[model samples]
Target: MLVAAAVCPCPPLLVPEVAAGAAPELDAARTACSDALSVLAAARPDRLVVIGPAEKAGRGTYPAGTPGSFRGFGADLSVRLGRADGDVVAERELPPSLAVGAWLLERVGWSHAPVEGLGVGESLAPERCVEAGREIGVRPGRIALLVMGDASACRTLKAPGYLDERAAPFDAAAGRALGAADIAALEALDAELARELKAAGRAPWQVLAGAAGNAGLSGTLLYEDAPYGVGYVVAAWS
Candidate 1:
């Protein structure tokens, strides 16, 4: 009897003082994320494993985590976190994150990866959300998975429309006009990612659309009303 999930929003780039002028929109995102985190904290997992690189780690010793590593979220609920520190996860045995990464690599190409202190790294495994649940010994009916990444990791603050990298609704026509390749890259990445997550054993899977690289596109948000950014929440029994 465990079913709760939330899809948090992803602004273009969140700064240290996220609350200075990030009211309303950021509040909504926080509320959404807090609800999901509460469910996660209540899961009572042996560990909370996150497959992400260290945000402020160095190029040599890494920040503070390793791939397939473990960490303590708190006394109520713990998690096993995974990070590469200064390097990328081994392309093959990156555990539950490889397949989705492969799909993105095949389409978006590595040139678009947000490395170091920039965009969302190739840390999220389409199946890692499942892997996390299973690793913590959470029963099939009591698990929560969160998949987060930079909504628009391709464009620049110096770009035409998104001059400040602020998260906003993307106009479809303007997006499509930017370039088909970029749009295809993100779409392909997200589509395959969603499918992979669904197949990873998270029934009732839900994908919260995201927007991070739409300024370079050539279309307007018409039917797909997915907005400028996307967030996905995957939850199911172990």
Candidate 2:
């Protein structure tokens, strides 16, 4: 299976600006991701599979891209899904971590799954760009799943704390605005997703560890983001 993989960041695809330094933190991330994708592609899989939030779904449960369809990101990446020509679709479901995040949102507390709610964008989007690479053959153990999701900070439910002020100025307040309820929701999602993706039965599919990315924009909604977070994080089933 081409086995190509991409980092699963939360938004804007990481500002290129935050990734610079002597050690170059983001550089290392980019390097690892680039290397993994290259390696996977070389081995060859029918196509690469990435787990991203699709516009078609909401933050309720683990949702996968509609089978036999592709979600293309403009001027960015286009994700190709399903082997409709044959019959091989992802045998698994959305991981447990993702489920947790959604649950928390509906609850009264924060999920803490490291959510990066797009202050500007409508919502997290579906897989794209990475899948545009040329198709290769399928190869097990040849796969490498790099990950990077939303930034730790976000505009999810803006709130510093219960006792703190309800609102603040600029995007900085986004972090503060997040309440315990929001944190709980994010945690639930991450936890559930991490667990589901780590299934031992799915070998060769390394679930790279990761942390949240992208602090989101200056507003308090999840839509129309330009480009902010995007990087590979740690994984599961490694």
**C-alpha lDDT of all candidate models, in order:** 0.27, 0.25
lDDT of 2 by residue, 1-238 (tens): 2222333333222323222232243444334334434443443433233433333322222223322111121222122122134443443333322221222122222221112221111132211111111111222334323233432222223311111221112122222222111222232233223222221111111111111112121212211121221112322221
Model 1 misplacement above 4 A? 1-16, 53-120, 123-146, 152-238
Model 1 whole-model lDDT (C-alpha atoms): 0.27
Q: lDDT, candidate 2, residue 150?
A: 38
- What number of clashing residue pairs does each candidate have, in the order they appear? 40, 80
Tens-place lDDT per residue, model 1, 1-238, is 2232222223321211322444444443443444444444544433222222223221112121222211121112111123233655432122223212222222222221112111122334424323332332333333233333323321334433233222222223222322232323333334243232221211111111112122221211111112223222221111
Best by TM-score: 1
